[model samples]
Target chain A: MPKEKKIRVLIAKVGCDIHERGALTLLTTFRDEGMEAIYTGRYQTPKGVANAAVSEDVDVIALSDHTGSLPIIAEAVLAELKKLGVTDMPIIAGGLLTQEDVKVLERMGVTGNYGPGTPMDVILTHIRNVAC
Target chain B: MEVFLHNLTGIPRVDEAISLMKARNIRGLTRAISIVENYEEGRDALLNDAFQRASEACFTLGFTGAPGVGKSTLVNAVIRHYRRSGKTVGVMAVDPTSPFSGGAVLGDRIRMQEHNPDNGVYIRSLASRKALGGLSEATKYALYLYKAFGFDVIIVETLGVGQDEIDVARYVDVTTVLLVPGYGDTIQMAKAGIMEIADLFVINKSDRPGADLLKKQVQNILYMKAEKERPPVLNTIADQNEGIDDVMEAIAEVRQRKALQGQERHRKRIVEEIRSSVLTRLAGDAEPHLDEMAGKVLTLSMTPIEAAELIIRRIQKGCLEDDEKNSI
Candidate 1:
């Protein structure tokens, strides 16, 4: 039997930041592009996000961060995934990132680090490419 | 034709998954559900083996109703209640798959995020893909796997349903239908399909006006049934956790009554599972010939009825030939 491959994404927001208009927009965009996107909701801990990704068996983990804790939250989530022996899972971040935060995500091997005003098409294409 | 008990051969992942499931590994449950959800190769083998190991220790609860009835919110409250007692829960939240894109946005988990990383609570979102009955086709198989994994409670939260989408009742041990105040009047309560399936009725958002009126309407609807057979109607403000304890108590009472007829439920579920599996297999086998037959009909070589009959005859003949070959 052949299975239909869907790009399953876990879209989430880390601690204390409830600015979700951007994340919700991106989630809808992913759905429009025919991806199975699930948002774990706001104020999620790194551990919660990591566990949800593994349990949902999502292809990519997209974080919607706005509290300037992108690097910290991304690192913790990556570490938690590592604890579950999930090392190569694709991690992406968007919202409220400075140049330094983007560089930090790059060093940590996170893909598609986008800030506000970045084109939705660019984010979508990058996600499709990485997930595939 | 073959012995349908167990066929773990040619599927190495099943071996690993079974072992993981034995240890209650979350990843194993996740992988097992994915295999069944996608109908991947060896899905039946996995499900068959899971059935053999599955136990009746878990209580399967179903929550279904129209949109925005606070089903997920109520489920969240129930999960907290169960977690406080140190019981393990496995939740499957069903949302509709987009008919055009064949994709879905599973937002149910957003409501249950507080339970994450608890290990005692596992919540998975399912897309109601191609299943018009407010459930995924793999739901029954997923329940078997969850049972094998030894959860104390298994909850299936269905997509917001209309009148006739009551398939969830067939698969669960207890079905709780949620309704908010002002949802409908007495006529809607007396309707046949969704109202008849519930073992319990929940008027969530009971803090709103008309809550008492809805409860009275439900009681009037249940007035015809035997007192023992009547499902209890309870009020709840799920977000603030008001009245959840009463709802839980009503559920326990209903579950006790439901347990008495467990064998009947099991028999019905067996028939349904087999019937659906055979239909799905036959459909898959017949799918490859559809385009050719449609083309023949388009060219006026055959009528639509004749085209369908031809396909059926071919499939029947093919089945006989395969049987003969196996016998030889």
Candidate 2:
């Protein structure tokens, strides 16, 4: 019999994105789902986020992007992760991301881009699947 | 599938993590904090390595008080003060773990969100899992991690103060026990363990009616304890941002006096931690059989006192069994 595992997700903010209600919501949501959520708070740079991901030993990296500074911030974050030799860690984006932005993030090697209004159930399922 | 510590396939080895901590890389710091919090095997060795390499910084402080005393808000004010002076602060706000979920409500961070955008502050809400004294046993390790991470000040706010929650005294440089205005009389509140552990006293919500009497009682109690200098007592209406500076000033004075005394807090903390760890290990060895004893407890086969004694005896018995096995 396999024991149930607690999925550990490191939630980080990119750029100067100060709005993190979405991140906080997801933190409680993930915790309620029996996952361990480590929040990095706000105003994290790309390298900072990447460093936290590797250091916390989180199963996934979820970037909370509300900066509306497209591509550059997300691009810098992904590039940093790769540069640090974190090639295959599942990366997810949450908060106010549009369909077009999600496509951009996906193109940049993000495993999932969860936009606003994406059902909580779907996000939770995706996290569970990717974490396992 | 994993039994100990959060694991990552690509996670750097302990050496790399140490180097990163030296470089003040956020990831390395994060890794060290997580590893310590999880109580992974060889954690002491890893932490000792970090501690040996760490510079003397981040004079540790602890705030202890009853629930709903605005301790977190007071802490937030302190963070703002430190950030204004361009000093980095690492805060560990420990919350009670839900017995069912083993997760934190984490509402402490809500009061702290204002500092979220400031690069000078890092706030972590840890769930105290079965740890007594209003904090996880791992909190001391996390403080080491934070000190190595270069925070100028590391503040540990326990979930709430109770009769047995004086463990903060063993760990922090100076402990300020926060109390609201309407606590019982000085005689009522000044129990043995609680008063001695407090390096300072804060009566928050000074705007309330009973504030003066509470402050006077604390002062009188301190006056009677003639063996040492009395700890300074102050007032703060944390909600209105009132008297925050006085608290900081009081803390600064305490820190200065402690420094003049030659960093005895660190030495004391080490001895306390050693004592705590050894006892905790013995308790852990005894704890596994408590499940069976608990069944006996349910069925009236054994009284609770008997069950406790059985667990206590098992600790020594387990050690003897290991000794015999090693001899063979």
Best by TM-score: 1
What is the docking quality class of candidate 2? incorrect
* Cα RMSDs, all models: 4.8, 5.9
Worst 10 residues of 2 chain A by lDDT: A1-10
Per-model TM-score, in order, reads 0.93, 0.77
Q: lDDT per residue, candidate 1, B76-187, as tens digits?
A: 9999998888888989999888888887899998888898777678888888777867888877679899889878899999999999988899888999999999988999
Which tens-of-lDDT digit does each residue in A1-132 have in candidate 2? 112234678787776777879988988887777666777667766766665555446788877777666456768877777766667788777777667886887788776676678899998888888885
Candidate 1: Cα lDDT at B79: 94
lDDT for residue B304 in candidate 2, whole number 0-100: 94
Residue B217 error, candidate 2, Å: 4.4
Note the DockQ of each predicted structure. 0.47, 0.18
